[model samples]
Target: MRKISRGGARQGPGWFARRWTAFWMRFSGPGPVGKLASRLAAWLAPPHMDQISLAYLNRRGYIDATATIYHSDLRLGQNVYLGPGVLVVETKGGGPISLGDRAEIHMHVLFETGRGGYMEIGPETGIHPGCQLKAYVKPIIIGRGVMIAANVALYSYDHGLAPDISICDQPLVAKGPITIQDDAWIGTGAVILSGVTIGEGAVVGAGAVVTKDIPAGGIAAGNPARIIKYRNELKNADKINE
Candidate 1:
């Protein structure tokens, strides 16, 4: 076994060791005991390339076998969970990535930051499976206790569409950061474009393409995400009818 210094220089396992670990991870087995064993192996065995401290593991933070994290400045809070097939990767000129305590990133989610971009996921937030958060030109900040459903895509930058330039060669531009305030709920398949702020306690309906800001306690739906109603309005309506 290769000696891994806790909080030391980031050095991953050799090709052979990585291959063996991948092979070993395949037999995670079928029941509760098997699941427990697999989680333990994922937390203990394989040599990680990032600066994930052993103390985080001891605090019950779980990173699944298939997850890939490649951030230069990575910080993990207590009991954070990175589920299977999750990828935290940097593209070009990437910046810091931090996850607050008890943040859960579910299966198959791709979190990418590049071009001097940064990202911070707050505590008690749960990002469901198949979500893609691509940050560039600005940071993607997800506040505490937020719930983001499956297939939600949030992009913090847009490409410059000059007529002469090929779309592939276009430069990335952004109005500002993508901020999701505390306790917001983003529905499945929603696409949150650059510079939009989803305010605290707001709810975005499924399949909505948000291009503008959604105010706090607002209920937004449809393409371009119109603010359908405020949550407080619903409560008031109920009281008036009674």
Candidate 2:
């Protein structure tokens, strides 16, 4: 038999390496040794036992295995679901990122709050695939029962575009706070800028660029997102301001 090269040996055999990688991936965040550590932590740190479990425990709760959560101060509430390839990243910034209970995020979704970061997402919010939310300056609050469609980007901050300082080099800068009120439905590819509040039960049309506040129970669409119609309807069939 020919001599096995060091490089080839280091990489390992194809099948075994793949299997080993998969197994190691399972134990990556908390690691396989967490089985014992988590148990000990739960014992030693008796108070707030849930904290010990969350810090080290890894369990199957119908969440897609491909999802990735990277952060020390990550808070995932009860029964929250994540689909495949969801990336929740908290890098550089030092603060807790809180996700409310029962928030359903679909495939390829990104929730990134790092480098002057904060995120507070409310309960029962359904975020479809390809949604990206980056809150860098204050906080981004997504209220309860909201539905965010695919390819939607809610950015609470932006970089300064002046020629003196390159945007790539500069850090995230917030115009103001971005808040999505309860029961709002943001359509596909909608972009909600900073310092705006989407009122309760408001509808943001697809491909709209929202720059101002959307009134409660209002329907808005298009670039600069004009409020075209009121959501309420009269018994006689006229559009009523809600």
Give the local distance difference test score of model 2: 0.72
RMSD of every candidate to native, in Å, equals 12.2, 13.2
Residue lDDT tens for model 2, 1-242: 98878887777665464444334324423333533333333333223212222322234212444667776776777656565577888867635677777777777889888666688888888898899988787678889999999999988887777778876887567778789999999999999998889999999999999999998999999999999887784244554563
- Candidate 1 is scored at a TM of 0.75
lDDT at position 230, candidate 1: 94
- Assess each prediction's global lDDT (C-alpha) against the native: 0.80, 0.72
| TM-score of every prediction relative to native | 0.75, 0.71
Query: Which clashing pairs does model 2 show?
Result: none
Error of 1 at 128 (Å): 0.3
Question: 118-149, model 1: which lDDT tens digit per residue?
Answer: 99999989999899999899999999999999
Residue 157 accuracy (lDDT) in model 1: 95
Assess the local accuracy of residue 34 in candidate 2 as a C-alpha lDDT between 0 and 100: 31
Candidate with best TM-score: 1
Worst 10 residues of 1 by lDDT: 46-55
